[model samples]
Target: MLHVLFFCLCLRQVNGEFVDDEVKSVMEGDSVTLNSGLTEVIDEDLALWRFGAENTLIAVINVIVGSVTVYDDVLDERFRDRLKLDHQTGSLTITNISTLHTGEYQLQTNSVRKSFSVSVYASLSTPKISRDCSSTSSSSSSCSLLCSAVNVGHVTLSWYKGNSLLSSISVSDLSISLSLPLEVEYQDKNTYSCVINNPIRNRTTHLNNTQLCPPCPECGHCCDVTEAVIRLVISALVGVATVVVLAYDIRPRKDE
Candidate 1:
């Protein structure tokens, strides 16, 4: 009977002396607030927050005058200088959280260990096509269309002419741009479009011919078309720019 009474007293001392207020579901590069409310804070005891795979010690707030200890640690540089705690509110604030910083957390107060967990998820936005496309007919040889995406790098780009798949290009530069070779020469109007799709977003652009170029009359070699070539180049540039601008501008307003 005496042993049972002693055991009950020890359990009460352990449970009543310290309490754990945990946090959950923190996003990467963000912060989390953990609150340990009304936990007895004693001058003889220390409150500590530890994190990581190896259980490296993070921060320790000394409890004095029966008051809580406050600590702050930023979840940066592989959890170096990334964990923090506030004794006043018993809140553990972690900043700049990353995937590596996510795991089980153990809070030790005066030799008592309370375990909790934190999971960090990544927040990603869809990619945007920030450039434009243009097409023009050259009297010399063939028709060509120019398509580009701004601020995009190392992605695949696909071109289409009126629902027909033209080509697929792999881009390595930051600003994605491609010039498509045209095999068909039209004397009238042509509708051309380009579509760029990636893991994050898919963008489509429609380009219209700037001027009507009729075929050479009665076996003429070719239209000298020096001016026409220049005009076609200019038009292609403009079309690409417009598509990128419009795609960027209209996307944000819809999200709201």
Candidate 2:
């Protein structure tokens, strides 16, 4: 548990030789520059950036002589011709963000002698679902939910139903088309969400929800669980805020 907590902290880091995932509202086909603070790398120093979902580094962007060189680790053969890097500017660019491109990216760099690490997040293309989807007869068997991430030379996929983790598969990116069987009842009106997460970036998509209808007989119990989950989430947020506030309040002023 302590190790897991430490890993989570490492993933959520913001500054001081660290990169935080900023909640940016970006549209498609926009180029955004991710700066690694000029302070971290002085002028004339070499810097590099590598991106991946887990232990392996999928793509690399090398910087030298005020230029960048990109090397892509071809996990899927399809990405061989698709991925490109700007050697002149040290910018990593993907031609078109597809549903498969959403994953965590690891940025590793060096400043003269010392090495530093950072993370970048990419989001999945969220195709909106019609709000007027009024079909309770639709069962889970009609659709599928899948979340995927690259982990240590393999991609891990997990399927879920509401809060229950149903099935998972670990395979090479070339074999990532596996599917899981599901059966959603008409009463299961909950929106099924696929939260694909890695150390760098995380993407979430709502697969589907049986159309809203009259309350189920177990509506009261479901409501109780929903309320409980909400309270737990809120309490966790409040606790984190309290810790931050208290830590800042007690820190000595640098001017002193």
Candidate 3:
């Protein structure tokens, strides 16, 4: 009869109402700890941890049985060798985490039930700036440019003119490319920069107007010079050929 009462109490604790979920954000390759919020678990208490929408069991601690299990082998080994459980508090720590680990985590204990929403973001890559050569024209005074980043996700690619934001583009998919375009005068001396950022971190690349958006080449003068050089070479070759022909005819005709 006493054992049955203890089992009933355990069931009530396990089925307790869960509190509001807490949100957590972490960078990729960093460690995050999902605190169980329990100071110390009693010997008669049971602590359980689950992950994802499927409620897959990832960890469990039954102090009464003196057993602690971490199911890191499940989920296609994604959590393999990465899960750590604090036996005292029933907290879970995921080391060297990636975006694949972003999900919902639940912890149930005899004292309280808690939920956490973990979001793992990839590190921001530096934005690259290049001239839009296709948009270049001798008559156009403005220089068209593109700033891009590859294999980035959950980031905003933005163009900033000094302290003001000029334009921006955002993406949420994984391992995708992002590009933002800006046009500025070739002689403009204003500071410009391209930035790629997430909620936690950002990367910035400054623009070098003189180097990237130099004044358009003088195509007309270049073509004219090239044409003149070609004509001069052709004329010289023709004159040489005529002189050789005349010398051969004048000197060799008598011998024939």
Candidate 4:
């Protein structure tokens, strides 16, 4: 049995380093377990878990003693009440993890040190489509579009036309909103969409020029604009005709 377990652990390593799963994604406010899988832990055998590049200490466990100690100096309120250490398996569990918790983690024992990556993403927020006309007060034929996702974390925002990717932005932050603009032409009929996604799930909003942005009218007024334009044109024509008639009738007795 010991030989079998040893072989399995050896297979999990390359050269001399223990290679972790490429990346594990967990939704925010959820839980995950990082298994150590080390057996026959003895006294004086210490297991350590650390996070980030500098390897800020998180927790330490004594196998034979079956005791867990967290490094409060390094892991303040952020990890309190949410971190768990299992003495039997040397596994670490995190509950209610936020986007701030996304990073690479390291586990070290006397025998081997292993590394794994974790990415925590928030619940997907719906992308919002809003008009970005040249004139905000009135409609304009030249209107772009803005798609936004509010206060999302560790995700990507992208604009697509059919299957072709137009543009995309990635956010590593856990608490900020982001927007992407599409320079759409007037009466654009192509199927365009704004999608916000994490590795696990995504949200999308379809573009509609008619719904969010309508064509600008000749007049700025929303109500009776067409009628007002017609009346103004007629008045200008009538005034021009009167001037022309006067000029013709006066010719020198005329036109002064």
Candidate 5:
């Protein structure tokens, strides 16, 4: 009974040190390996792999019994057949991984115990840029523009002007959209770009001022021409009305 108590205390102490020693990020639909750092599993050694908050057993290797077991059928078969255990190193590899597999993974053996925090991120979409016509006011000299990304999560969306960051926003949720706004002078000729990035990859879309926010018609060009034409038509109608009034006054005075 004394020996049993001592063994239990030792086990608890070991478990207390099972904090996450490494963090890993992987893009969805890719494979990631959680290495055990073992050169070889000796004849008397036993290695075990567990996952998630429930600590469900997923894989086991016992060299003494000459057995290797993978409990992929458990946990609603979320893992299915995508688990691979290295015989020599006792490492575990997850193939064709998705967001559903994201969580903490624990590896335990006679000599070493470690934990890994894994984050799986979806592929980033290309950012889009458009003129915010509604936000543009006639009195404002700067053009209003918006950059957006849809169906993206765990990313940073930013606007850059000639390698300088103008604005940025980040999101931690899943499968959401983000939008950022920027104001630039309509006549300014400068390079601008929108970028969306995750830890593993990034996508960029360059801003096209000519296509999105073209220069307004010159002050003395189309607008001025339209105003001049309207004034000329109004003046001609007024002149014809004045001549008719004078002719009626001169002819009606003789009858009176």
Candidate 6:
């Protein structure tokens, strides 16, 4: 057993031109196809499809003898009932993809050789954002938001203040719902967004801090005192300046 393990490790060390690297991205529970680009097969031709860096034999198609074999005994459980071959093109289809299926796939024939790198991503559900009122404080009524999703894998959950990302978390193959929290003070006037994503797709929700967590106090809501005070002072100064300008113009009425 140790010798076989050592040989497999050693195999990972070799790289060669016979490897025709292709990239394929498929969502978890989905299907993907690897094509051989062969339009015809002859009696003397030999075609083989394999998986992994070790090139474990997967399927064989001998059109000359009119036979097809899916070497199930050599395949892992994930590929059982999931692999199909096209006799004409020699393309392979993998159904119900999962993280376990992510890896290298190889196709070999008498005349040509090729390879593929397949990546399986979990589908991320649309994120739901809800207000968390218990996070309120006396000095400032903060708007805390919770973003959540379910059944995600190999993906990231993140919070963004406009285009600038704030906080992010990642996991692989989580079949349950998870959430991330974001807090913004009432006076915060910037835009915030929450996102759940993988390399294939992203779902995002946007929030305007001023509208969602307005600065003014209402219904026993916490408000930022310093920010409200600053607003009041600015309003007062603008009023006083307007009165002074009117008085100056009115006092010159004698010249008119």
Between 2 and 5, whose lDDT is larger? 5
lDDT of the structure predicted as candidate 2: 0.43
The lDDT per prediction is 0.54, 0.43, 0.82, 0.75, 0.82, 0.74
Query: Between prediction 2 and prediction 4, which has the larger TM-score?
Result: 4
Model 6 lDDT per residue over 45-67, tens place: 66888888788988998866789
Off by over 4 Å in 1: 1-23, 64-77, 127-256
Give the alpha carbon lDDT tens digit for every residue of 5-114 in model 3.
01001122234553756777788888888777777887437898999999999999989888999999899999999999998888899998888999989888866777
Off by over 4 Å in 3: 1-18, 137-139, 209-256
Writing each residue's lDDT as its tens digit, candidate 4 over 205-252 gives 888746646444433565577778899999999999999998888897
Model 4 stretches astray by more than 4 angstroms: 1-22, 39-44, 71-73, 135-142, 152-154, 170-177, 183-190, 208-256
Model 4, C-alpha of 229: deviation from truth (Å): 19
Give the CA lDDT, 0 to 100, for residue 81 in model 1: 62
Worst 10 residues of 2 by lDDT: 1-10
**On residues 1-256, what C-alpha lDDT tens digit does candidate 2 reach at each position?**
0011112222343455544443222222333333333443334345555444443444444334444444543556424444555444434445433334444444445532221232223333332222222233355434322233332222344555677876655444444243333334445666665444333333455654544232444657888999999999999999999999988877766435
The digit string of per-residue lDDT tens for model 1 on 159-188 reads 666788887776554453443343345443
- Residue 171's lDDT within candidate 5 is 89
Cα error, residue 37 of model 6, in Å, equals 2.7
Q: Which residue pairs of candidate 3 clash?
A: none
Q: TM-score for all predictions?
A: 0.37, 0.31, 0.77, 0.62, 0.73, 0.64
Q: Is candidate 1 or candidate 4 better by TM-score?
A: 4
- For model 1 the local lDDT of residue 67 reads 42
Quick one: how many clashes does candidate 6 have? 0
